[model samples]
Target: MFHLLEKRIAETFASCIGSLYGLTVEVQTEQPKHSSFGEVAVPAAFQLARQLKKAPKAIAAELLSAVGPIEGVAAAEVAGNGYLNLRLDRGYYGAGLLAGESAESRMSAEKIIVEHTNINPNKAAHIGHLRNAILGDTFVRMMRAAGGTVEVQNYIDNTGVQVADVVVAFRHLEKRTPAEVCALVAGPARFDYVCWDLYTKISSYYEEHPDATAWRQETLHAIEAGEGVEAELAHLISDAIVVAHLNTMWRLNIVYDVLPRESEILHLKFWAAAFELLKERNAIYLETEGKNKGCWVMPGSAFRESSGDDESKVIVRSNGTVTYVGKDIAYQLWKFGLLGKDFYYRKWHTYPNGHEVWASTGQPRNSSPSFGHGSRVYNVIDSRQSYLQDVVVAGLRALGYEEQAANSIHFNYEMVALSPGTCVELGLELSEEDKSRPYVEVSGRKGLGVKADDLIDKLIEKALEEVTSRHPEEPEDARRRVATQIAVGALRYFMLKYTRNSVIAFDFAEALSFEGETGPYVQYAAVRARNILRKLEERGERLPDFRAELAREAMARQLAEEDCWQLLLAASKAGSAVERAVRSGEPSHVARYAFQLAQSFSNFYHEYPVLSEANREKKTFLLWMTDYFRAQLEHTLAVLGIEVPEYM
Candidate 1:
């Protein structure tokens, strides 16, 4: 409702300026620095002062008289050199909110593809992978709330060096045959966890004996050739690990529409189709000299400005193997439907909610739902891979898809690190040198990072202790359910609270705290709102019909109080907060808004006693305010991917 008023005011002012000055200008609106001034401030007169050759205050005075009455605005005044301050009609605004007017504008109908959680199918997902998935999933929710169409994609690198290394370990180091490996995957132990330790052992062996790297190269060839025992081993390990990853993500309520694998890209000749286009356009040339001799390389000037010392990026090595970026370029083209190729799709898994996830296959299968051909694409990756993402976009531009190149967004975020205190809590022995640093970076190659399942289990265990202490008479099953909700809320909120570029130092105690700027703090406010409504029912009294009992005159009378007016205003901006967060490409803004809204409700809850008021009309108004706050709190928390527990 607030966003709607702002738009109406901007349009009215833009028309007034055009009629009076015969010149068009875009009008921008902002909130006043102090509430005493007004709700909105406009500086359009300042923007046109030079063109009109007049003082800003005089111009502001003229526009103030020329502009007609706005729907929800009560008065328009000229203040401070040229500013236009507009105060809203509180009675009119509150009435419209009660009538359920929408604040979101309809977005474009074009489909947007968001690809994230591209963890390699080699080891268990760590804390770093959680950040990527949570950020991506929350962004998806925000877009959908604004009425935009979106398709989620999770890319799988099943035939990469990471998977090859694991295959080499099983074949050479562990001496496990195909039959034995299948039994291990079917055993009681977690397959991803078993492979996680094996990956570390193989990495250590490579350091001790340099000659062992040849095993990786040999395994890579067999996997790419799509034949032999090593190829079968790669499939067994990667397929099982992929299932494990999907299960882990499902626990957080994250699901995808498709899984595009590198193995399908290889067998389907996606690179071959892209290679012809690159060669015809001369995007890449064979390097006959220098260190990259006999390799097809893209010149560095295409992606970045040349500094004379810049080196060209190799697209295909001398051994005729396409580099990761080269294959990624093909994948990017397919995303926009520019490449003249398509993948055979098969139903991979059916989630409990009846959502089906499709996977790419080399062989043709039953007809499936349309997968690719997105109007825009966003690749959610880490900040360290920005260079590779740039090269992929450059490939699109060099091949004449200028519009697609512009729309390819690299949604990059910083890595997640662990605080020294967290490392100690996890039972990791820190050296004196490591203890001096503020945070320790996790290394997957060394198996030195916290696993996602382990972290979740620990959080639930702690939350259960709290739940058991507070609700002793409740059933054990009920307490366990609430504990899971609290644990998920803590984990998801901790990953999303920071801005995309800021590094997050994961601390267990800081995240699980029920006080001060934490997920549980925001969640407790929601639970409190629910309790107020529940208490009313428990007292043998039904809720009053707000629309019938509290008319515009009654709302105006009660909202005259400064405190009541402010709380209602804050509760009405949930839609506006989500729209702003989407435009700025930041999910942290929404998280911050949720925290602020929760704080406002807390203040209102302490000051006003809704159930014990003496005046009948005033009691009904306060009850209505409580219900409105409860609705807004739940809506905002849903966008942040956090759930309020039954009790907190």
Candidate 2:
């Protein structure tokens, strides 16, 4: 109701003022801090006073008289100096909310592409990667709720140095043949966990014996050339790890539409096409007289602050090998349909929700769906890659694809660390100094970070302990189901409660709590509302028929009371909160809104006794409000990717 009335009031005033004053104005709104003031406050007269060269007080009086009656507004009055304070008609607003009707659309129908969870296939995903996947999936939910056509892509870096390092480890350190490695991958063994240990071992060897680093370059060349046993070993490692990643993400309800592998980008000659375009447009030139001599470099003047001595970014090395930035530029161009190239596709995996996930292949299948060519692309990566992201956008602009460059976005975020208590809970050894610090940084190279699966298992175990203690009579399988839901909700909400720029120190105790601003707390409020309806049925009384029982005149009479009106008004802002969060590109706003809505419901639940009320009309109104709260809370939780369990 709040989102509906705000748009209706803005449009109505815009139309009214344009006719009377011959001035076009942008409508702005603010919430009144006190209940004595009107619900929606607009300061339009202050904006128009500047153009008319008059005091704002005089302008407010004139516009209020001429604006006429807005559709759902009961009265319009000028507050203090020039603020346009408006009161909503209680019957019309409450009836519309109960009916689940919304105003017209506020967004365009353009298709958007969101790329996230780009975990390297060489190792297991850690706590940091969970943050990226949760943030991306939640944003996708918000965009779809706002009427957007969205396609989710998870880019796999299979041909990078990370994959090559594992291949080198197997061949040199472990002395394994291609057929033997393939057997290990196909056998009943956890291949990804094996690679995770080998990756760290290889990192330590590179520091002590510097000559061993050449093996990385050699393995990379073989992988890029797509020849020899080393290349086959690389493919085996990456494919197994990719499957492991998909399974881990599935536990948290994260699914992708397509997987665009970097190997296909190399095998299909995407970089060659991009290299030709760069040279043709003078986007990159060969460096001659510097430390970066014999390398194709993009001029730093294109992206950096223009100084005569700016450093150039190398795209291709003197050895005729393309750098990671070069491949990234090509991938960005393909997203906008500027490159005259496409990837061959094959179905890879099918999710439990009946959605098929496709993958890019070097060899063509019988038929394929066209991927890429998105109007806008959002790449979810860490903030540490801001420089590379800028270079990719600059490469697009350099090739005269200005619009595509402008549409590309880097949805960057900081890293996740572990709280000191969590580190101790994991049985990790910490020094005295480390224990005193607020958070300990996670290092995948040193095997110091918490694995994603390990954390999820711990949460489930902890939740089950609490669930069984509360409901001992529940069946074991039913208890397990509720525990899984609570664990997922706790993890997702903990990741999203922080802003994008804020670093999170994840703690299990803070996330699983059901008393404060947590997912379980909000979920319990929803369950409480549901139990009210359930208990009424158990007592041989029918639930309120909102359509037939909740008449406009009855609602207006009950809503005239102070507490009833406040709770209804607060519940109506759920949709508006989602719209604000979508526009701001912040999921924390939605998390905060859910917490506030839960808080309001808790207050109303304690104050208003619906079942024992003697008056039928008043009881029906309270029951309807309880149902309204449940619906709004469920909708908001869905947007956050948090599911409410039936029992908890």
Candidate 3:
């Protein structure tokens, strides 16, 4: 409701300014620092001050006079130097809320592809991987909430060096054959966990015996050859690990629409098609000198300004193997339907909710839902890959897909680190130097990070203890379910609260806390609202039909109370919050809004006596407010991929 009103007001101001000054400009609205000033403030007059050669105050007065009345707006006035302040019609807004009016914007016609959680199918997912998935998943939810057609994709690097190293571990170090490895994968052992340890062991082995590094290259070649025991072992490890990854993500309610694997990019000759484009367009040239000699390279000038050094990126090595970025460019082209080549997809997994996830294959399968060919793409990778992402975009531009290149978004985020306190909580021995530091970075090579499943299990165990203490009479199974919900809420919220660029230091206590901006705190606020309604039901009273009981006049009288008005206004802005967050490309904005909304409801709950109010009209208004708050809270939590438990 707020978003619609804000949009209308901005358009009205733009139109008014065009009429008054004969000049066109984009108009933007912001919330005033204090509610007493107004609900929305415009600084268009200041923007026009120099162009008009007049005092901003006079311009503001002129625009205010020229502007006609806006719907849902009570009054507009010029304030300070050049600001236009709008006060909304409280009763009108409140009545609309009572009617269950939707604030959703018009649906976007473009299909948006969000590629995220591209964890290499080598080992167990860690906390850093969790941050990527949660950020990407929440952004997808935000876009969908704003009426965007979004497709969630998880890219699998099944044929990468990470996978090669794991294959080397199984064949060379562990001395296991293809049949033995297959049996191990099919057995009851946690395959990803097993590969995690093997990956670490292989890394140490490489350090001890430098000659063993050749084992990796040999394994890579064999895997690329697409035949032999080595290739079979690679497929077995990656395929099973991918399943483990999906299961881990599903535990947090993160499901994907498709899984695009690197193997398909190779087996289907995607790079071959891309290589021809680069040659035909002169996007890449073979280097003849310097360190990049005998390799196909994209000059630095294509992606970045020259710095007087040979900074060209190698697209293909002298060995005729395409680089990661080379494959990425082809994948990006495929996403925008510019590659001309397409992948054969097969059903891979069906989530419990019946959402199907398809995987790219080398051979044709039965008819399946169309994948890729997106108008826009968002690759949710870490900030470390920004340079590679730039090169990929430059590749598209060089190939004359400038519009597609512009639409290629790199949703980069900082890595997650473990806080010192959390390290101790997890029984990780910290060095004296590390103990003093604020956070300790996790290294997959060193096997020095918390696995996603381990962290989740730990959170649930801790939450279950708290749940049992609070509601000891509840059934053990019920308590466990609620505990799981709280655990997920805590983890997802912890991952989301930080801005994308901000590195999170994961701490269990702070995240799982029942107070102070935590997920459980928000969940408790929603639970409090539900309890109010449940208690009323227990008293043998039915909820009043708010639409019938709360007329415009009654709404105005009830909303006249400053506290009531503020609470209702806050609750009604969830759509506005999501829209703003989507525009800014920051999920933290929505997270911040959720915290503020929860705080507002918490204050309202303490001050208002909804069940015991003597005035019937005011009581109905407060009840409506409670129900509305609960709905908004749950909706926001769902976007964040967090769940509210049946009980606090």
The most accurate candidate by TM-score is: 1
lDDT of 2 by residue, 1-648 (tens): 688789889988888889988888878888876778879988888898888998888988988989888888998888888888899899888888777778655778887999999999999899899999999999999988887888999999999999999999999999999889988888886787888889999988888899998999999999999999888998889998999999999999899999999999998999999999999999999989778889999999877877464478999999999999999999999988888999999999999899889999999789888889999999999898999999999999999989988999999998898899988988888989989999998876777778898788888988899889989899999999888888888888888889999988877677666567778778888888998989999999998787898888887898898888988898888888888999999998998899999999999999998899899999999999998899989999999888888786
List TM-scores for all candidates, in order.
0.97, 0.95, 0.96
Given candidate 1, what's the lDDT at residue 642? 85
Q: Which candidate do you rate higher for TM-score, 2 or 3?
A: 3
Q: Which residue segments of model 3 deviate by more than 4 Å?
A: 102-104, 421-438
lDDT of each: 0.91, 0.89, 0.91
lDDT of 1 by residue, 1-648 (tens): 999998889999999999999988989999888777878899998998999999999999999999988988988899999999999888888888888886656679999999999999999999999999999999999999888899999999999999999999999999999999999999999999999999999999999999999999889989999999999999999999999999999988899999999999999999999998999999999999888999999998889876342368999999999999999999999999999899989999999989999999998977878888999999999999999999999999999999999999999999998899999998888889989998999888888788998888888889899999999899999999898888888888889889999988888787666568877778999999999999999999999988998888888898888889888888888898899998888999899989999999999999998889989999998888888999999998998888888887
> What lDDT tens digits, residue by residue, belong to model 3 across residues 475-580?
9999999999988888888888999999888776776665688888888898999999999999999999988899988998888888888888898899989988
Query: Global lDDT for candidate 2?
Result: 0.89
lDDT of 1 at 607: 99
lDDT pick, better of 2 and 3: 3
